[model samples]
Target: MEKPQRGIQSIEVGGRLLTTLAEVGEPMTLKDLAQQSDMPAAKAHPYLVSFGKLGLVEQDAASSRYELGPLALQLGLACLRRLNPVRLGTHAATALAEELHQTVALAVWGNAGPTIVHIEESSHPIHINMRTGTVMSLFKTATGRVFAAYLPDKVIEHYIDTASHHSFAYPKSDLRPSWKAMQKTLKEIRAHGMAQVVSEPLPGINALSAPVFDHEGHLALVITVLGPTALFDPALDGDNAGALRACCAELSHRLGYAPE
Candidate 1:
């Protein structure tokens, strides 16, 4: 047996793979796994087995499918408790989602881009997202835009340049807007510390997003509440904006971003 690829084989790479799995909750095909893991199928196979053995992931019996197993869930929940943004954002998103009966997400910059760290689902079947692990761009999405806005122009430019319009397998063009337009949008987000986008990224998806600053006093994460376009308002209803701001303030505080 070729010596099991030993020692830290780029913790960052493993981190990215975990992030990918978190973003895509359902079991993925080997091809999908390779693409999402950014590794050759052959390479991923061994590690997938390793992870399965450790109970970090489970290989489904029916279709030999893979989804995060119970152990992984245990670890994830443990990590969530320690993660500042998750702690703050999860409660906030959950409350808002339950109150308005809309989907809410607390997102943050992961290895590749913006990733949904926590999600609160709506009550109705007409709700937006049913599952977690959805990844979207930091350029075109409301949460992404809030994330991009806080970064430098060069950082924002990179996201615009590298962003994929449709995140899945099928590569699509014309879905992405011009970089110039994205830059202008980022400018506005920077000024306001938040952004609202309607029916743009995915049709009928309306959302409001804002950045959460950390102890370093830099934007560290984003939180967004999403609903059908029919419920969107030109402005967030009474106290909603204040609630979001308060959440950001608390999260940032926990992260060591105390104001001077």
Candidate 2:
């Protein structure tokens, strides 16, 4: 006997239509959807009708524009729940820490800044006052810089504006660099796809961090490794740096980020 077919032909075609709409990230009319899906509007109408009945597509009665339905949002939320960056980074961070014998941390862009969400510590303990939920500065730490390098300009602008008013232990003069210098640093970080800081955020500590991007090429999470400055060397080609980049690239791949 032959193996069972995986999916109905009509369903596969309908899925292509749905994906085309999703890729555009906007509601589209029948003509636009048909053209984008490379099908005739007459052919596409039937698929849309089925999708509408199933609550996978919704049409605006006024304009006849079609958008993803509530069910699509429900499905997207479910997918996001499964794609939690902290959960995805757990295994990778643990393996890196064990292999390199350094503290590995996972951070995500939080309301305040790059917020630590998970950590894997090596056998050798390092003294630093940080834990899950700790938010680091946008310019002072490797994890924070990786976020600064990748996050949108508006978000970084907000951070800078907020940081100026709130006083921190670090002298304001030191924390805020000339805009020119800051841009240059961020440019270099973008070029390298990673960031490193040595004994700046905290004395005697050194860190290197690489970004993990989502399918949209947005910063999803950052993986960082830290150790005593004396023991940790933040070399781009060094063992720790190479491992961190590889681990982050793997995570990004899982998130569907394909580099151009």
Candidate 3:
């Protein structure tokens, strides 16, 4: 036998089609798929037929639309099984803590709100006590602002209620900015894809947070970095904010988020 090549050309071409489908995140007609894949319809159809036979792609008889099939789901689930968001985020969080020399946290959307599931402390020793399982306040902390900036309105409302009344230690008097003003601030946070808070929530503390998106384009988690205000600043376009955003974006990419 001659030297064996790594991959078949036809399979690689078909993979482009599958990736196009995934990137679109919707079913498409053969013509649309071919156009998107930059191939002729005739060429695309045969590959799709093969994919259908192998259970890699499926077609709706009623609508004549093509989509990823059960095998693709099985493969995706198998991949996701090993790539838990928190587990994946830990590497980035640890590196970020070392880079910034501050307290870094990874928070997931717990039933109560943005809950800190992991924390890496700075070697310099900060004066805060953020531990694992500690729930961050949705209205006060930088991590909570990130969730509020990205999560659905209903979920935001639920956490807002909790933070305003029961969960957060800060009373309403400490929560500055009127309701309308807070909305404007959150809008800015969403536009910037990060949040920053200085003092108020916890005196002498400053923080920055960025949201991590999953494959479904939903907010999966947030990476937050906090330190004493004397050293850390929460400016809109600060150096630390940029680093935090880069880290979150990297984690989001690992989770299969492709920005449009």
lDDT of 2: 0.85
- Arrange candidates by lDDT, descending: 2, 3, 1
TM-scores for every candidate against the unseen true structure: 0.57, 0.67, 0.74
Q: Which stretches in model 3 have alpha-carbon errors above 4 Å?
A: 1-10, 29-32, 38-43, 60-65, 77-83, 98-102, 123-125, 153-180, 199-205, 215-218, 228-239, 253-260
TM-score of predicted model 2? 0.67
Cα lDDT of all candidates, in order? 0.68, 0.85, 0.84
RMSD of 2: 6.4
TM-score of 1: 0.57
Which prediction has more favorable TM-score, 2 or 3? 3
- Model with the higher lDDT, candidate 1 or 3: 3
The residue-by-residue lDDT of candidate 3 on 1-260, one tens digit each, is 89987888888888999999988979999999999999999999999999999998999999999999999999988886687899989999899989988889899998757889998888766777678988776677888888878988787665555656765445655443454567887899989888888885889888889999988799988998888889886886888888888898898888878898
Q: Which lDDT value does model 3 have at 102? A: 86
Q: What C-alpha lDDT does candidate 1 achieve relative to the native structure?
A: 0.68
**Candidate with more favorable, higher TM-score: 1 or 3:** 3
